[model samples]
Target: MTDLAVTLLLFFALVSTAIAIALLRSLFAVVMLSGVFSLLAALLFIAMDAVDVAFTEAAVGAGISSVLMLGTIALTARHEMKPKRWSATPLIIVGIIGAFLIYGTLDMPAFGDPNAPVQTYLNPDFIARTPKEIDVPNIVTAVLASYRGFDTMGEVAVVFVAGLGVTMLIGGSGGFLRRRYRETVLSRKDGQA
Candidate 1:
């Protein structure tokens, strides 16, 4: 019962985000919806006992991505042209996809079953490695921050590149003002001469 509730909450959050992304006309609204989606996903990860993933998603997906998107939007146009009507075909497609996802969820294992294959398979390796090879009190941190450090570095680099690209594309740091200043200087020189 608890598992079902959590799963339903996650599904509803995801679907609401998808609908918001599709239906919202403004880019700012879409960015905000994406943040909401990211927050929901982080909560879902927490519910599934993936604390590291939830923390990363909350920090990067919701916080950083939304901030970067808002910065980009500031350099772009403020208002979008209002459409008179929305087409129904996309909504129909979305509904079908949602139904298929829900159907697939029926086959998933019940949460926290000790006999589940995933736990059964990993339990031995988890027990054997902690005292000998890993030497860490908390295995999750050791695995993510130490064993898989390269992958984490790569992910951070990717995020840095994305921020760089957004900064380059937005171009909001006074290009027009520099040109206007140059023009003013030239006009002042001409008037003096």
Candidate 2:
């Protein structure tokens, strides 16, 4: 009961933070709220006993992501520009996708069901094999590093690609772009004087 209450509270907080992010016009507030949202999501993951996932969310989502966004904002605008016009196409597409996702979840087994396929099969297999196959003292480390190494590598590659994309988008040569921007501003001021 206590766990359920905590999970529910975290879920509520996550939703509230998401709504606030969507509604706000200030980029700085949005970035900070995004960090808060990530922290709330990390708490939710912890509540679900996924400490590894929680740690990743806190580090990447809350910490690194927030810092990157702040940097981007520093190079861009503090406030979001007002939209020229509102369109329902995006809202409709999102609604349709959300409905499909909810429908897909309807067929999933209940959370923490003891008889679930993963619980009955994979868990025992991993537990039994960890000591012999991997010889790693920490089962979690063994599983993540050896058993699911390719998946982990893929995730790392994704993060690397995302960071590279952000860097390219911000400025291909980050410091050079900043220097150019400063020169442009100074030159404009000199011309005005």
Candidate 3:
């Protein structure tokens, strides 16, 4: 009841900030707004009683991603180039998808309904067995590090492969390194003379 209200309020606030960011011309403001949106999303997750998701969202979304965006901004211009025309096709598709997702929410059970399938099935077992199966406390980390370690390993591998692909695509035989190599060879020949 109260949690739903808080979640809705936070969600609306996040959406409003995102809209304002899209409307603004300033890159820095957009980045800040994105950070705010991420933070609000983390809060919304907490309000929804998804503490594990909230923790990850807070750390990765609001913390790491915002810092990465800020670093990107430092290497680029603060002002975006004005586009000639706005495209509406992507926006229309996104709006339709968002509307459908929102529509799905109407069918969902109210938050903290004791009879809800989610509340009835897994929560009690985890609550009961966590302290016994795993001696150390903090069930969330225990589940992640022990039970879901394979998923974590796969995720790490995927990230590593993506990084390697990006490095090969962008950094190979192009940009600063090629120019630096040319300069080094030229400077060595000049020194010999």
Candidate 4:
């Protein structure tokens, strides 16, 4: 009962933060609220006993992501431009996608069901094999490092690609590289003259 209450409170806080983020026009305030949302999400994860995921959310979502967004805002505008006209197209599309998502979840097993496929099949095998196959003292470490290595690698790759894309977008076109190239060309012309 206590756990359920805590989870509900966290969910409410998350929803409120998300709504605040959507309504705010100030980029800085939006970015800060996004960090608050991440922190709340991390707390929710903690409530679910997913400490590792909570840590990652706090570090990447709140810490690094907030910094990157702030830097982007510093380079660009502090306030969002007012929309010329309201459009219902995006809202309708979002509603359709959300309906599909809710429909998809309808077939999923109840949370923490002891008879769930993973609980019945994989958990026992992992418990029995961890000491024999991996020899890792910690089951969580063994599972993450060995059993899910490919998935973990893919996650890392995704983060790396996202960071690369952000860097390229920030320094691309009429920005840092352009200024450096211009300076280099001017210096070479001056030396030659």
| lDDT, each prediction | 0.84, 0.91, 0.83, 0.92
For each candidate, give its TM-score against the true structure: 0.65, 0.80, 0.75, 0.81
Q: Residues 165-185, candidate 3, lDDT per residue (tens digit)?
A: 867755666657877988999
Error of 4 at 172 (Å): 11
Q: How would the candidate models be sorted by TM-score, starting from the highest?
A: 4, 2, 3, 1
lDDT of 2 by residue, 1-34 (tens): 9999999999889899999999899999999999
The residue-level lDDT of candidate 1 at 111 comes to: 65
| Candidate 1: stretches off by over 4 Å | 82-123, 156-193
List ranges where model 2 is wrong by over 4 Å.
135-137, 156-193
Candidate with the larger lDDT of 1 and 2: 2
Q: Name the candidate, 1 or 4, with the larger TM-score value.
A: 4
lDDT of 4: 0.92
What lDDT tens digits, residue by residue, belong to model 4 across residues 1-193?
A: 9999999999999999999988889999999999999999999999987888899899999999999899989988999998799999999999999999999999999988989887898899999999999998878889999999999899899989987886676656646877899999999999999
Query: Every model's Cα RMSD, please?
Result: 5.5, 4.0, 4.6, 4.3
lDDT of 1 by residue, 1-193 (tens): 8987998979898998888797777898899999999999999999888888899999999998899789878978655778878789977998999999999989878867788788788666876787688788877877667667899899999989987875565445655676688899999999999
lDDT of 3: 0.83
Q: What's the distance in Å from true for residue 126, model 3?
A: 2.7
